[model samples]
Target: MTASPSKLAILTFAYVSLCVQFIFTVGFNHQVHHSNFRPSPTIRLRATTQVRYIQIRPGAQFKIALFADLHFGEAASTEWGPLQDENSIKVMNTVLDDETPDFVIYLGDVITANNIPIANASLYWDQAISPTRNRGIPWASVFGNHDDAPFQWPMEWFSPPGIPEVHCPATSSAHSGEEECSFKGTGRLELIRNEIKHNVLSFSGNGPRDLWPSVSNYVLQISSSHDPRSPVAYLYFLDSGGGTYPEVISSAQVEWFQKKSQEINPNSSVPEVIFWHIPSKAYKKVAPKFLIHKPCVGSINKESVAVQEAETGIMKLLVKRPSVKAIFVGHNHGLDWCCPYKKLWLCFARHTGYGGYGNWSRGARILEITGQPFTFRSWIRMEDGDVHSEVVFS
Candidate 1:
């Protein structure tokens, strides 16, 4: 049947509307930005200039500082209080000053989006890593569930045609929380890539270019300083994906991990470590109790548990890959345990950010990796500079 003029008009209007929306989205994407905050030190560091690969000669050891859940800019206006986020940064700096790690890896949830405006987010986020950048230390990171969550007080949309259709203020309508708002605000993917481009000291990998939608997956090869091609170890940074994304790593991501792990050039299964924001399913097996901070030969302190049930393939792959000896993660702010999950030790970095749910003393996990036998030792470096959760990888 032939459509009436009215029907034709409606269809035309709909098509035009969609086209206009796309244009607006493309145009506005450029406008959204984080505020003026210098993350780079006086001297801008480049990933290429800064040493990414670690070359562990015969008896030498590589020290790694793992800091997790530095949930900056959270609860800016809560009774939970002020300086919570600042305190986390302060703890990070103290650890850097004292230990002087060879490399630092932030295990996600780097920033809490709630109660924050999109523009001011950089101020708090930059502060979280200023210590490492200022020290010119090589650093990398993975994403957590909260990294992309909307700021606590996200910018509200104005009335009329200019009002944003997505990530609009939660109060745009009757929704009690920003969760109901279509607007997701800026996520960790963009924020992280920006740093990689701007800061040379940042070694955080941009996720798989062909297979991924966001920026939380990539391999940071720690090769011998003498020979860039000869890798000493490989660090895989995977996004556990939460908040706006699924809470688990996808099967595709697992396949990608396997592909990348296998493609370590001539070196297959060379010593490696996995850093993600969330723990794998195996973590729950031994993490039932919250143990005190004391590093034993086997495992160390145990905090509350938050396991990733969907990580079966990755865990299985670890068993097959002898090169991967340790898998470090953060999400359970109260937990800092490291136990074997088959072949590799499933470890947690001590929570360093005060913005998260835990009040447990802020701390970071310091790793000492030695070559030859390829064994390693680690301990929790607390905010007060005391050490705990010390253990030698079995």
Candidate 2:
């Protein structure tokens, strides 16, 4: 049909408009479908092969290696700083090689936040756990006072020229990933989050948000090797506050502990052990006056107990709970002892890192647990491969 020029033009315009609409519709739907399938950049998916468990064999003993106050990246700029970190790593490697522990516990102060002088302390934190991770050993950690403490500028660095400009090397153990360094210390939440995200062997957790300023308040159940469903013991890791806040365990944490314990172990049947960085006031009372003699066994007692800022019923609650077998902490480098406090024992790991102020030889506390008739035996494994201060938790 030979139509008029205007009619032909109108028809052509309509046809082109319809084609454009159709293309737009299909493209929009395709984009939406693919977007739905894509995962968020921040979200992580757990691989099926990543699943692991901690269980004690029926006839075998479950051993744990406790490395406290590794304090990696303490003085990154100084000549001796890196040397200290290397020594600390050697200490861990020595202990791990000798004990071949089933699990490892970094009982806080894994990195000295004040000394990190970097935005991401996890870099140093990662180095601290590298030995354990390399060995395919599972581990958990709790926050310590210096883990997220504010950075303190070295007074000596302040000269007449007004704050000498300090520069960090582009590459170092703490900067293994080549991340930009800063004085802003990494917080506890970020540290734990990064650990769990990157390391499949890490059992570390960022506990409830409501327990703000107090992260890492969680419990782990150790199941029997014979029966995976049957739990043998409970391990509680609490964030005794420090760094950004006062070094105290709040009443809320105590309440949380009570509720959580009741919910998990209503009958108080399972034997429980606790791990934290700071010691409580109860430690002061139980500490040996002169020498670490009978009833109390330890290699060193050169310093007084560095108790928490305040005691808000954690000790009281623990003392009343018969299921709590012992509490392990590490803060005071000069003191490493296990003293009885009423129903349970209070113990400390030997000063492990050379970064902190202590000339004491580096070592780690090793705990060996038996399942059938439950028993806990502990001793220190020194950097030089010496073992001493063996104690049985009764």
Candidate 3:
């Protein structure tokens, strides 16, 4: 018996619907696959349900690898720029594989914002930390002068047939959803917010509301491996001002530090280390006069210390606290030495990114801290897997 016209029509509609669904599914998957090749700064990865704690392993030392001045996305429009970024990644991977650090610290200048034409600098920021995140190694970040600098157009772009017109995605009905393809670079707040929201493994914080403009001014406590409840050491990250503001630690920041240090670590009991981008005026006071030898151990010292605009009370406060064993920074690409200053040591991270101006070899500064006797040691791990410039400060 042949089916009625209505039944026949219904059957045809069902068959077409199935075909359409199949096509839609395949197309959606294809789009996703291609997108993985491009930078997805906001993409969320597999994160632990609970916050992971940075701890010293039992009967073992806690090791941290510091990669500074990565300058990711610098000269992104040019050929040489991308190549430099690739080399920077190789350096990070090499050091990570060799040392297998428990934690990674992006000392600063993670992205050269002035060189990036795109409105969102997070694309480069994501790239800088991907190496650590990929390996399931927990990490933290502090911003640098170049991280949120105002966009600077290339001189050549203004030449020739004048500035070329560009188009970006926009709303179909209204201007509600549109892409901003402007020279305005992403600021410190947006960059830090994006990082903390997407990556649970990231221990970075936006600090306090009072400390506006300086978003990265928080403290991280490394718990004792034996006792998770007890903190063995503390790591303080300061937003040594730069980029959109004066390149100096503000007096307000000094006040915040004083209060936070007392609250978290009163009586100067716990061993603490500080990390920031720009060197303070105190660094200049202790810098090697002629040769970087004896008390100071490092490979390169070709340039003078690029001190901050002015000397705030941060250095003086740090000097008073004997618990503050050492402070690390990475603004000067040409210098990487640890000199004794008062009660603590002042060190510069080896230039780890190829995008920055420097012909010297690329490497990261490796720091190891033992919990039992409380010994802090540092050294440089080059891209070629060579290690040198070892120093100990207990």
Candidate that would win on TM-score: 3
Cα lDDT of model 3 by residue, 1-394, tens digit = 2222211110001110111111112101112122112211111221231223465656667889999999988887778888898899899989988887778899989999878766667877887787776665667999899999876666655525444334343445332222333344588999999988877568897888888658799887776767654667888999987889678888888999899888777889889999999999888988998788788889899999998898769999999998999999999999999999988999999999998898899999999888766778999999998999999986
Pairs that clash in candidate 3: none
Show where candidate 1 strays beyond 4 Å.
Answer: 1-60, 78-82, 151-184, 265-269, 288-303
Q: Give me candidate 3's TM-score against the actual structure.
A: 0.84
**What digit string (tens of lDDT, one per residue) describes model 1 on residues 156-256?**
33324433334333355464343443333566657786667656567777666654534678776655434545556667788887766777877878888
Highest-lDDT candidate: 3
Candidate that beats the other on TM-score, 1 or 3, i.e. the better one = 3
lDDT of 3 at 159: 29
- Estimate the TM-score of every prediction: 0.74, 0.82, 0.84
Q: TM-score order of candidates, best first?
A: 3, 2, 1
Off by over 4 Å in 3: 1-53, 159-162, 170-180
**Cα lDDT of model 2 overall?**
0.76
